[model samples]
Target: MVLLVPRYDEPRLLAAEMELIDQSFGIAMLGCALAGFILALGLSIGGGHPGAFPWAVALAAACALGHFGRRAIAERLSEARAGLYARGMTALLTVIGGLWGLAAWLYMDVHSPATVICILSLIAGMSAAALAVFSPCLPVAVGFFVPAIVPVWAVFIATGDSAYLAMFLGAPLYLAVLMVFARNYARVARHAIALRFANVELIARLREQTARAESAQHEAEEANRAKSVFLASAGHDLRQPLHALGLFVVTLGRSELSDKQRQLLAHIEAAAGAAREMLNTLLDFSKVDAGVITPQPRAFRLQPMLYKLENEFAPQADARGLFYRTRDTTTTVFADPNLVELILRNLIANAIRYTNQGGVLVACRQRRGCAVLEVWDTGVGIPITQRRAIFREFHQLGNPERDQRKGLGLGLAIVEGLARTISTRVLLNSRPGRGSVFRFALPLTSQAAQPADASAGTPGTMPSRPSLHGLRVLVLDDDPEIRTAMTALLQSWQSVCVAVESESEALAALADFTPDLLLADYRLRGERTGQEAMEAIRERLGRVIPTVIITGDTAPDRLRNVHAGGAALLHKPVVAQHLHTAMTALLSESGWRPEIPRAAGMRMHG
Candidate 1:
């Protein structure tokens, strides 16, 4: 069989084999010295040769030089010269083999069987040990094995004895078997070294990939944060003008006009209303995502909120040629009334928007000691694959072109978010062609709830115009257009109004007017906010005046700050009706009234 000589071109593998051989230098020297001294002693005892001691000393000195010199060579070995080192080690082992062969030649002439057996056995053992230590390089093993055995074979054949001749014939077969073993062992050693290198390379690649994944995740988090910041900044800026426009619209609606002019006005109002609705949708999503919506749960009858939503959406459903229906249940559930209403409003609106033919249904039933509220619709039903995806923000079905008329696609996402704040989740059940049902569960309360007041009004509903006639009001805002719009809108209500652009102007105006109510923007031109301005005004007045803090900011911290200041908080783009309601409620809470008529005491200051 051909010998397994690992390629010397692979510097790393060659260096690894060299290291393995270098480690065995001490053992190799010891074995050589012991064998040489023992053979010399055997020769002195058998033939009493005078040169035997000197010969042993020379062999020992050669072995000592070989060990130290190999170490010196190893210290100077570099990657480029590794092959040279391997060749030098092989030559050194061959020379050591020659020394052992000389021992055989010198001892066998004595013809002592004991001496001959001792030398032969020692050489056999040394050759076997060389295979173990030097098998990584096949050439080194072959170089040592041939020289040590060939001399013994020559000596045996030179004898005419039958026994020596037989041994001589068998010696070549023995050397061939050991060469086979050495070749197989060298193949295994090289395979193991290559495998170790492969494992190290794989580990390095794995670490690199892990670091890349971590970097990607960090980048995604930063991008999401940037998106939130952009929305907050943009929302506040955009809503400032939108808020002013709504106020102007309300003031304009109070003016007299012809039928055609009224119709055009109606169209203008509708377009403005649609824009306001979209902005409101964005605001709701931002509030939910910012975790600013805290649920205030209480025991309230669910019927009133349901009834209010029905009145709000029934006309839209009728306009679309679809039936609107609700089943009344006296199920008084414990939950945040406003959050529950918001959730139902989104569901009902989504149902009306998507359904074309069949009617939509809102119903409630008690299940497992909880009130389970459900909204059923005959819309294009959600598929199983898309059921979870529909709850993701901006995800929608059947509106790939993103038709704004179908809504901003945040209805269900808002619904889900609001439900979670109340310690629950919105669940969905749908079939492809039939319909879908959206539902959530709320705890059933044993306490008796108050009856639903049919006349109770929600925001956006026109309440019996709470007469603002002859009411003294103070408005502080930094925007010029907002100050103008507020002045005009409040004057149209026949309220004595004074609007200013800063805290100094507001404090200045206070000297001439004892305000009955305070209306201020949350953000102002200077360091003082509207809330702070109101507080400053209240401090100057020496009593808490009725206050409403209007804001266009949707950042969580901003909302929390406004809420904590103990003033009625109103978001921007407030509907005129809602603004009127809030002002009336605050005034009434402070026990103020219009003791004078509008024509007699009405005053306006810009």
Candidate 2:
């Protein structure tokens, strides 16, 4: 019922207070034993009080009996039992206080003032210790303090001496001050317990939230992995047909046709090209995430790459009625030429796509021993808030309708990914409507630039077409449409072709024919892969033939496996010119020189 003890409705707080009382109960009992023994001995020895020793011994025994079984009582403590335990402990404490008061009564008749003062001093020490030990529960502390010292005050008043009466009057105020101190101490202890419980509850809730978050993250990862698997499977299946379609269109282009037919064919080619570009973008993103794109840095002239990009994007810029310029520089930077060229190409293309009224600029300069290549565009500039988000995969600004013309929104993402592959970071500076500048720096090298390939001019420029006539080529693919299209395309170039549907058929073709080059599709029937077929053929021939692995799978793990085989890889829906370039380069390395017919110069367009 005391304010220091929480109400029964709050069982937890009440139980906590009772537990505190139990903890300090032993201290209270120990103080009682010591004070009782000392008081009784002092009275008997110094004041000749004969009965004090026997009385003290009996009370001490009773106090020890009450202190026993405390631990057992606490173990089974409950709300109802807590009240009983608190009342019982207080009762025991009050009985001990009465023992101290009895010592005062027994020693009051002592003649020696020193002996009387000693007894009073012993009683005061016991009451002060009890106050400290039981203050957390005010009722127990008050019970002990009142009984232990009030009896001495009574003795002082009974003497009727002026000094004793004065002391007794002040004693009540002293007790009242001690009671107020006990009350404040008890309130603070209760608040601390409440805070402790609140903190414990908060910790439990936090742990639960953390567990839920971990579960959600695991599910998200699973869903992403499933998505990658779906894309990889679908991409391979779709690329087979699309690859055949592009090759068939190229074959149609080679044949004689009217102007209208040619114009229609051009439209089909453009549509197919667009699809191929989108697929390639996805493949590039997957390769970067899969950690398959390793940068091969070397010294290469920046001017040649810039020229190639201009050639590539000039027509688009012209159609959009936006001027495109490239500032020429002899800066030879150290970086993977192919990756750097890809980064610049994406930036230039993105700039041209967004700009409607102003021009785009591609420039390079030397700074801090690095080549700071920049693409500046007077287009719809990116907002400051969207700058960082633009680097995230598939995130786009101002094109929420998901228009195909605006691209798949992967250009900047790929740009950032490729830059990271080369151990560099892309920097962006932009305004809302004026323009945007994209920049990244590559380490510059003093080494001489590698000799530019005579056959490999600028990326979009075709230097010359090498004759594939009289060149023996072998192709392995599972899809019948792909095999038929590939045979027709290779034959159109005047190259002898043997296209087979399986490895067994291809190996059978070798019985009467010798092959100069091998083209194998990456994924084949059953658990077999193109790498296995290539290894088998090479082992049988006892010589390493020039081989290229053409695949449509864009999954990161598949890319890593294809790269690990150390074969030249070309994605599906291969542009005719790109295929020719790859095959021509491989054959040249194998010392196969094609005899070019003395005809007008022919350009094979993709």
Candidate 3:
């Protein structure tokens, strides 16, 4: 059972109770002293005991002075030493109680019943007041009331009269009752103090818990930032060597070789391609994880995007000896075009990679006010149990051997991420030993118009060797291997190439060589960037040259910087054909006409 009254065993709680009693003691003492003086003055004038009046006044004055002195001492002491102050006050109250009892004894007379009654009443009142004032400390209350009432009882019993004897016995009983009441009151007060302290402790614990939670949140944020930094640094470093290797491979492909040498080179290229795919997949996953891939939703016809995918994957399907088909639709989709394209590209690529015998089909249909775009592939379908697992990173169906040719299994993961980013749901329908269908719904928009033809302009056909005859190309890159490989590639295309490693070198080269194009690396030696170099060179040349910034860094900030620079950006380990296409497009847009001329020598400076 819970006790309504608790023990005052806690030192802090005891101190608190003592301090409360101390604060109120002065007022209570003053009230008692004034009452004593008034009773003494009235008794002296009425009963003709003028000598007792002086004694009573002196006792009352002493009591007031003692209380004030205790208060002064209490003010100088800290709460931690309140026990000492409590003891001193208890002794003082005991003395005051004794003095009150003495006055009662001295003033009581056999001749005057009124004086006896008056003195007895004053003593009883003082005893009752002690119970109220000293109840917080039980021992102090006992000390006070015992001394205050005992002497009065003694004088009455000594008279040996029947009435006085009865009064004497009743006085001890009354004192005993008041003492019990004081002890009970003290118990209840201590219980309240205990609860107050408990609440304080509970509040303290809550503050500590809140502080710990905030600290943990801060640590998690710091770890996430560190992870982003590590990924950016690792991606940049990895891409640099891979970028140089790709350039060397392209240069080697341009040389004469036997059938065996050609086959070996093909193997090398395939291995490099697999590595590049894995790297790109990791980069995409990081971007999604970092929340950098934001959707740019717009209304556009779906047929053109489907046609683009069909044309892009046509060559791969033909190489694999599988038919590829796309059903044209006039449906319009309201979603981010680029994010939708990324999702579709991954789904289509996965379909092509897994299918061996049958074809892949890209189609769209209407469903409940939305366009359901789907990719159907006749391949080794996923089992029901493993369907949900396919969209997880590094999860693939029947590729346990970890074959690079089968892919790193990040395609479906990317597809799911991109789909979620655009607030679209990707659904799968598959059965073992049959085919599979991957589909997502896009909200239909009535604002888009149907085109005259549903064709993504024919996929650009990169020439076996692009002709840059009589054109001058300026190349800036910090890496010597990249510079040399680019110079060889451009020179092979019949262009006069000027390769330099720094901004100062490129500026020096530009004094004699006015190039038609500028291909610079995004990150160069020291703090200078390719964008800065391009702007500086253009300003010095007094004309805007078509520029392409090649970057190995997949960091979001660097990518955004390159994009904002208003120049075409090519990521590291760029395919030779893609680079050629970018150069040709820029040159054509600038109205640079290729002139049939003599072969130009490659110039390397700085």
| Top-scoring candidate (lDDT) | 1
Q: lDDT tens string, model 2, 1-606?
A: 243342232566666777776776776677677677877787778777778888889778867877785555754357757766767777777787787777776677534687767876777677677667777777777777777778777877777778566657866666676677778777887798799889999999999989999988999899779867966988887888889999899899889999999999989988888888888888888887788888887777788778877887988999999998999887777778889988988899889888878999999888978889999999999988889998877787788899887888889989998998999999999987999999999888664556352114654344568888877787888887888888888878888768877778777777876788998999877768889989988887889888989999988888889999967899998878889989988988899977564322221111
Locate the minimum summed-lDDT window of 10 residues in model 2: 597-606
- Could you report the Cα RMSD, in angstroms, for every candidate shown? 4.8, 5.1, 7.1
Which residue pairs does candidate 2 place in steric collision?
Answer: none
Q: Which of the two, 1 or 3, has more TM-score?
A: 1
Cα-based RMSD of candidate 1: 4.8
Each model's lDDT comes to 0.82, 0.79, 0.80
Q: What TM-score, over all chains together, does every model reach? A: 0.79, 0.83, 0.71
lDDT of 1 by residue, 497-542 (tens): 7888888888888888999999999988867898889888989999
The per-prediction tally of clashing pairs is: 0, 0, 0
lDDT-better candidate, 1 vs 2: 1
How much does candidate 2 score in TM-score? 0.83
| Reference-based lDDT, residue 22, model 3 | 75
Stretches of model 1 off by over 4 angstroms after superposition? 3-202, 314-328, 352-359, 383-385, 398-400, 432-435, 451-455, 458-460, 465-470, 535-546, 588-594, 598-606
